[model samples]
Target: MTLLDVTGLTVTGRHLIVDGVDLAVSAGETVGLVGESGSGKSLTARAVAGLLPKGLTATGSVTLSGLELLGARERVLRSVRGARVALLMQDPFAMLNPLCTAGVHIAESLPRSPRPPSPFPPTDPGASPFGTVPADPGASPALPQGSGAAPTRWTRATRRAEVLRRLAEVGIDDPSVADRYPFQLSGGMRQRVALAAALARDPELLIADEPTTALDATTQHEILMLLRNVQRARGMGVLLITHDLRVAFELCDRVAVMYAGRLVESGPGFDMAKVPAHPYTAGLLAALPSATVTLSRLEGIPGGVPAAGDVTGTCAFAARCGQADSECTQERPPLREIAPDRHTACLYEVRPRPRAEPRAVTPREASADETLLRIEGLRKRYGGHVALGGVSLRVGRGESVGVVGESGSGKTTLARCVLGLVTPDEGRIELAGLDLTRRARGGGQAHRLVQCVFQDPTTSLNPSLTVGSTLAEAAAQGTPEGRLSVAELLDLVGLPASYAARRPRALSGGQRQRVAIARALAVRPALLICDEPVASLDVSVQAHVLELLRTIGRELGTSLLFITHDLAVVRQITDRTVVLFRGDVVEEGETARILDAPAHDYTRRLLASVPPTP
Candidate 1:
């Protein structure tokens, strides 16, 4: 019997969204809802949770445990929410209260959780060394020392013990993490705490909505493993909603492809990954940029999703699909089974492209003596708190150097020092023999020697200016007479000249990234510093941008100081890698060698924490 069932789900507000979609989740299975932004993946989940915003009318039979959710009253759904089903929302910081400790938030989630027979029972035969213990009975356990909390109430203390255990299970080894507020921890660690809190109630249905989107690559892998363990132990059905097809294939038992508020396909993980039947699904799989895939065949859908309010076509994806024909444009396809347990919503059967062959990036053409960036004993002190402890590194011309580290590991600080944005207390940085520490502040030669592409184009670009105008501003030099047109810059970045007239807000995340790259190349900086450039884009788009960066690096012979948390991306982009931890450089070597055989203890932990690649 279906644990949760929905048929002909139609959700509409002031716009056209979530049209006639059907889905079901068994008692103990994971179903992935994969799509890009505004595809109605999230709106469908919200309808199930009875958490839709006001004025939204949902017309469907959302029967969970024989109770309809579409029109359910708030009071009724409240009991079902934490007690029966829990939601792990997209933004961890928004999900957590800033003023509360990790312990405080986790405690609030367990409204009436099942007791573990004993508050401090003996470890389960299957329990790992760092599993959640039963809550203490009779008396609450004491909080960890130096948590900045006075001897507290028994209930609060008991909750703290359970919270600490949960955090540890989610790969946060620092016991004192329970004491830190949400603001103190890194994005990945905070999300781990949020997951711990969500599972505190142990609901039968877990709705994980892009829970790992904001984390570093290593943390993302760890969280995936933790969830796998949790799913096996709890036997809970999960509805994992995300834009990452890779994550869906790796974690979900079954996958559902959504496009413009409709189910385009559904099938087993391996089947969908290996051979997708729908045109949209096939396009999505083909766009992934893996080490194995060549650039000739990897291109994304040309247009964005149909407007939420104007989705009145035969097929929502017809506008962007390469194979779309008259029939595809005239009538929407129904979700019909093409094979056992594999459904397709396409007029014509579409074949999925072959998986890319993963090849190690072998860009070893740069000679060692042709140094592009050189750092010596870089140190930064923030009122006695040292951030970088005698750090030093070098990058040869035409090289991509990867920087890997936990949050606050001096990664961004080092990037800032290299960019000359921050004055280091000690040591010196030079780009092509030009002292960045003593650059021309009056808009001189030093400014043209290096450029930086920061994270989040939304904030980095001037919102008021068009993409064309912003690119022009970056190219501004001493004499106003020597200026390059914005169209030339856009063309250089593989964008249409028409895009030069468009505002930064009008571009997609991937497009915005390309624009940023163009702006950085304006003065032709010898070395480029990229801080998580692709962190904001979808997986398929991420592949394209990485390839773009690699192409630019090769074609221009521009050395890069690329700071990212994604080891997968590192493997395909970086020639050499350096691992940092707690303000100290842990290990530095070739990307393949370091990942395969890390020498330092911290580096080993990082390597171990990465989830086993599927």
Candidate 2:
């Protein structure tokens, strides 16, 4: 039986965004919706849940267990919102109330029912031996035989027990966790709490959007396992919306690919991974970072995803497709089954992988004897907690080093200490053989020696300044000929000259990240520090960014200090890898050797936790 179904669904705002979409999820099954950012994956999910933002209208038939929900009244929605259907949003912090306790949130979603009577009667402590009368007559309460009226309301004790049980179901066993706020919990624990709340109502269907995107590799694997177990136990339908093809194949039973608000392909997860039916899907698979060997080059789909409601006539992905023809532009192809259980929307034959020329060996193997960055005995303490405990590392000229660990693993603290953003308690930081750790704070040579690109470009870039001005300020050495020009920097990062006039808000997340990189390069620093630079980007965009960074390191001959929690990313970019655990370096060696034959137990666990490539 279909647990949730959508037919002829279209969402429109300033223009037609999602058009004529059809999909279904049956009981005891898992379906994954995969697409790049702005490809209408989340928008389709919002339409199904009847939670579209203002100005967006959904027109479609959304049926849950044969009940129509499109134009249902608020009262009708109230009956199905939590009890029959539940949604777990992408951002747990955004979905949670910072002011409320975890227990309160879980308790509120529990099903309401009349309380059962206590098993034992209220008796005096002194007269409980043989059913004798109590000395104090008021101590006992009279009760009728057999079946008396049940209590009309639930008590506080009953609610607390139920909340703790729900928390335990998601593996959050700490009793005090129920009393803590969202800010007090880690990202994984917060996600677990969100899952507990979703399970509290015992819904038949669960919609999880980017459930593990913000988590580390180990946390991500654990969450996937949890979801798999929960789905199997309850036989509930799940629609996992995500951008990770590896995750889609790992956790979902069936997978569907979407582009520009349309379903382009659908099939069994394992089969689709081995043999994709659409060019877009094939491109995504090729872009995944391989663990077998270090990838010198990663193929990326050309051009960006089209704007919502801007696609007109023919195939939406034809503009960037290598096999596109005049016939493809003239007619729109209908989705049809190519195999027993696989369906594709394209007219061309599906290829397992794109043909590529032999990858030329990148010349980043040799490092100069000159050291660009040196750190010794780096230590930082925040009150009683040690952020970085006697850590030491070095980066040579034209070499890239990777610092990888989970959250709260001192990766960011090390980056800050290098950039002079945070003062270290005891350490020696040297750039070009000059110690700058104990120097006074100012925009001196220290800032010019090292520049940083943070994880989030949206918050890092100044919204008030134009792209041109931002670069100009960084390259403040007079005329365009004497110093690096804004236009030149923009072109280097793959952006056009005209983008100089646009502000940060006018650009997409990928474009903004490129601009941030360009800004960091305007000064031509000796070493660049990138802190989870591509962690938030889509797979395709991340490939492009990584390629660009590699190009910068090769052409500019600048050293790089990369910090991230993803081992795949580290393998692709870094020459040496340092594994950190709770502010201490557990293992450090050549990137490939450390990953393949880890010496430390923590390093082995880290590699084991990575999502397997299909």
Best prediction by TM-score: 2
Per-residue C-alpha lDDT of model 2 across residues 21-133, encoded as one tens digit per residue: 88899988999999998888888888777788999998989999998988888798888888878899877999789999899889888778533332322334232222322
Candidate 2 stretches with Cα past 4 Å from truth are 114-152, 355-369, 439-442, 477-482
- Badly placed stretches (over 4 Å) of model 1 are 112-176, 291-301, 308-311, 354-369, 381-386, 438-444, 477-482, 586-614
In candidate 2, residue 553 scores what lDDT? 88
Cα error of candidate 2 at position 224, Å: 1.1
**How many clashes does each candidate structure show, in the order listed?**
4, 0
Candidate 1 lDDT over 243-324, as tens digits, reads 9887888889999998888998999988887778888887787666543222333356666777645655687788888787
Candidate lDDT (C-alpha), each: 0.77, 0.83
In candidate 1 the C-alpha lDDT for residue 537 amounts to 81
Worst 10 residues of 2 by lDDT: 136-145
